[model samples]
Target: MATCTVALTAIDSSSRQSLEYSSANQSPESDDEAPRMSLLRKLAVIIQLSGVNFASSAVNGLVVVGLPTITADLKLDPSLAFWPTSVSSLANASTILLAGSVADSIGPRPVNIAGGVVTGAFILAAGACKTGPQLIVMRALQGIGYAMHLVSSVAIVTHTLPRGRPRNFAFSCLGLSQPLGFSFGLVLGGILQDLIGWRAAWYIYGGLTLALSVVAAWALPNFQNEGTFKGTMRNLKVRVDWVGALLASIFMTLLSYLFAIRDPKSIVFICLIAMSLPLFVGWVHRQVKLGKPALIPNALWKDTAFSSICGTVALSFGVTTCMELFASLFFQEVQHLSPLQTGLRIMPSLLVGVALNVTTGLFVHRVPALWIVTVSSIICSVAPLLMAVIKVQSPYWANAFIAQVLAPMSTDVLFTVGLIIISDNFPDNTQALAGAVFNTASQLGQALTLGIMQIVSTLVTKDYSDKILPMARLEGLRASFWTMFGFMMLCTLWGAIGLRNTGRVGLKRD
Candidate 1:
């Protein structure tokens, strides 16, 4: 009862706090500068923004599909094999807050362009690497660049474009581009692995992304006026909440590292990771009391809708990421499929994602967010459930294909809706931080699930010592699949209660 009262109080305060801009449809003509944005220019800007997502996400896909080939050629240590796949996410999770905070203060244009350049250069460097460690380092560096691009891209969309059809379609495209790029990577990685090399894939990705960055220069609007370099630096020093930012980053970075390494022996990492939360809480309390800017306003979580969306996004995205990785692993290891075959099998999810994103964009304003999120959560739960009970000899069409289609249902929907809700919860001016906070939740979920799933798989697989290696691996995957199922169900239940009052978002406004 006490907690509920506090939550309600926070909700009331937050209602007064956040201006619900993203869900209310203000047409493109609302802003004077918006009228001058020609259709061709709009399309170009959309491509430039969404293109970055596609390219960065493709790196993750390529890593997953091409891991065996990459490891073998680069002579990656057996122990560090997964690092290449996980490190990019790790890096992204660690620094996203800082990137968002900086972008919000200085302007997103510089940050976005710099990120693109860094991402392309690092990817190219990754391609040129001969050592596994070098590749991992480059991937980590590129992830930071991706953090810059990802956060800024969202700010650019939310701030520059008005709140109606143009913005809706753009957000939808942003959601679509991620899975689309991942699917593209899976197919492209396999083809390159078989014919040329994984290096060639990186070269292609890097070059194209660099080209997109160049286009983005002229394409993206100056929604937030740019400050001089000296002025920007000074603003960052004074306006930014450095203590809150530091506490948040340390917590995220340390916890993620512990999760990734999973060293039961590292008591120190465990203790520090545990300590970060309270310190962050203290910082938040200070910010709210002092009436200063916070990295993530402490009051935001008091709203049932925002909190629920954050939880759902973390779990849903984590599961989606896990499904993609584990599904590929299942196809290859349990069924003994080839890399190309594994990539082909996962293509169904991408098609579903594209379709859902488009549909959600067009009709989201007319539908209740509660129904959209909860129903999709129920449907996507089946994807992991299929894998949890599947037989080795099961036909791909009978089981895997359906799972693929179901896997993306909730997440793709949530990507657009969650962004809407998140954008709604934050002030319009702090779009970059909102993007960072949203992405941080997403990346945090990925980090948590990846770490936890890997742990589950490892422990479960170890118990099946009497079984053959393939059988043991299958058992591990099943355990993780069950874990994924639980996550989706929780997401569904959370939404059912939390979003009961969240009606028809994205409605047209003046």
Candidate 2:
């Protein structure tokens, strides 16, 4: 696999070079401008971009911490309660590719502002939802907005910062926002649940998003596709692959819907999953035929570095998310901790992540990203394995705390490094696409894997009702950890074998 990936990398490099040579004669609109802002101004822009990431992460974290309260308050069937998170992830996974394509064509600034507005509105509306179905609809809309925010935020960062130290630093700060926001959400969600009620979490999230929208409008630059086409409707229509985007969205939506449905035995669900396979194949074929305007250009598959990193990142994200969800349940149900206590207990991991985020940013360009991934993979694998051994009577400091700390160390490092690798390999034209693919994989990984794991947990724990013995339900949670352990082991092997030890931007390659 490593050898095959290396060969593909070579092919992709040569092909990209050839393509660039052929396009050399084209007229230029404007290449990326060199950064001219003072350090304070640059930091302010970074804060704005990172704030978008922070808002998204905060929402996700709130879901994780507040799900139990939501389930109880909304009178949701325990089995169906996962829908709020799963549905949002499904919507995000389905739309992100199209969002990235749109960002590339129209520029990131508009997407950022528009996405923030939509996300804020939907989240605020979600606070008023009276039924599970209403919440699902609002969450799905919020997901679309999040997809826009995610892809465009990364594009803006990559576009604004040149390769090397500044870009690395910016990327690291963006990465840091995820954990920072997540930690804040966990605490805030717990407080709201205890004080004002779970609905307050949504109100706070919505308010933050609205503020970020204003910041994005003021901070983001409106960089166009340099020399690609004039701002005419005909040219715009020709440049954007509407058909490809539609097909890709349909395929992902079908795929996500298949996983979201609880009934694996349902003929309709099975048929949808089966149908998506062909739709996906057709989308790939369409992209191949369409060339430049394709939602996902054919050239991306040939870029071995990008492809490998995407796969590894997806799997890692899936396992990590699954573990987090299960752990949250374990803390609340088996250990009988309050939501606030659970949030506080999870803090050590975020602290570790903060330190590593800084370390990764400062050293990523000096180190080979694959090495960081490989080491993190190994550590991540052990964390889940430890969780699998934990019992209802296990000590918090000895079992849960250690795993939390080790787990985030791996996830935070991998996430930061993964973004850096994606930004480094792709050119400016496809930066948004690359970001979209990266984030889509992360969201899909969470949605699909968590869906599967939820089903497994339900089945595994069904024999012992929570009414009979609360600790009995943990049997399934432990099983999920073991399953995550297996996935992490696979990620470790893939990182070691399939991934190349590529140095970050401007580093000397041996």
Candidate 3:
């Protein structure tokens, strides 16, 4: 198998000959230089990365929407079934900073290739598991692989492409690819699970990932050697606050655990929160006072563009994810829809998500980032507010469906905008940091929203029917929509007041 992998890699590399010229000024204008297919190579890179996105999305959609199915099939407890995704989240969050450092020290090419290999391997392994514990362990490893792949891919995209409208467009296009994967996963995974089985979906995704890994080895540009050991050693000499990393991880883990347990008023959970909260806060302050390169760089956090983008990502993403997951529940459990039926039911919003993703990428160069974000946030909030007002007798084609369509447009539009802003703001040296932070915010925000919505939904349904009737479910669903409404409104306010207005095109380096 290993030999086969290497042979495949070799074949891929031979198909696409890339010429790396030394100087920054080197261009394709010269006749003698092995004719640089920069455009072709960039296209190849985007296509390759889009495959990675598809694989991850396929698996995640299975995990998220297939939760009810997986739990029932495996005979696992409903609550514990969250372990696969929770483990994935924990591992992803833990590995990103370390991977960022590694990517910066070593060129992104090797790290990216390594991640592709591991991601394919682990995703395949996940399919072979029979029990929840085994599944969680494999998923966690996959998370590590994902962090490496994501950081490496984004670093390559941001650094390899010159910083300008082209780079901004690439970032937006990549963000757009996210929804393509997600939408495909939802519709396709549901079809596969019904026609064959849920486990088959995993195996199929694994095959796709393995095939894409080979393409990556061939078409993606090799990591440009940005100089030697001396450059890396200089960065290593700068202090890395290991203590800060540990503290932050501890806080993140504990907070997530607390949220998972959904015991907001529990003394034990409250005490853990109380103790960890202050320690995490104090540690961040100490890192700043000592001028150390903490788990999160103080300088990066202080950048208005970076911070604004992060906030927008957190809230906007939180709403989209929460709405999607619970909407599945609303359709499946409340309205008694089939899994395929539920997937079809949500098509309005999901389809709109894909459309906006593509449109935003195409026009991002001509629009202001701030205005795009603000308008999207407002649209997102209004979509949910419209849903919140839906009556039990309301038809899908009425305000509910219209709101759903409008809802995801804003969510996807802001996603592209946020990615463009962050990619443009960070230095080439910090490409991994930029990717890690953006993904981290998006992922954590999703996780946080799921947990919070669980609590709010439970509260609203506490006194309701035993079978979770549609009327009761609708009430609980409204509460969740209100939560999303609040989040998107906040995103709008922050984007308006806090973000530094920048061109729709990416910023040029000083």
Q: Report the number of the highest-lDDT candidate.
A: 1
- Candidate 2 regions exceeding 4 Å error are 1-32, 225-232, 264-267, 282-292, 465-467, 501-510
Q: Which segments of candidate 3 are over 4 A away from where they belong?
A: 1-38, 81-87, 224-241, 263-295, 465-470, 500-510
**Which candidate, 2 or 3, would have the higher lDDT against the true structure?**
2
**Model 1 clash tally, residue pairs:** 0
- lDDT of predicted model 3: 0.69
Give the per-residue lDDT digits (tens) of candidate 2, residues 1-510. Answer: 342233334423332333332233221211223233344445557777778778778877888899888877778766578988788889998899888878877777788889889988998998888887788789999999989988887787666654445556667777788888888888889888889888888888789889978877766665745234456355357766777677677767876776666664657766766776566667767767846566665566676666777778888888877777788889998888999998998877788878988788767777666688888888878778888899888889888888888887666777767787676566667677778888887888888788778877777888666555575678888778888888888887777765674554433122
* Models sorted by lDDT, best on top: 1, 2, 3
Q: Which 10-residue span in candidate 2 carries the lowest summed lDDT?
A: 22-31
Query: What's the TM-score of each model vs. the native?
Result: 0.93, 0.88, 0.84
Error of 1 at 180 (Å): 0.2
Which is superior by TM-score, 2 or 3? 2
| Better TM-score candidate (1, 3) | 1
Summarize candidate 3's per-residue lDDT along 313-385 as a digit string, tens digits: 8778778877777767766766677777777766776667666866676577677777888888887787778
Q: Which RMSD values do the candidates have, in order? A: 7.5, 6.9, 6.4
What residue pairs clash in candidate 1, if any at all?
A: none
Candidate 1 deviant stretches above 4 angstroms = 1-30
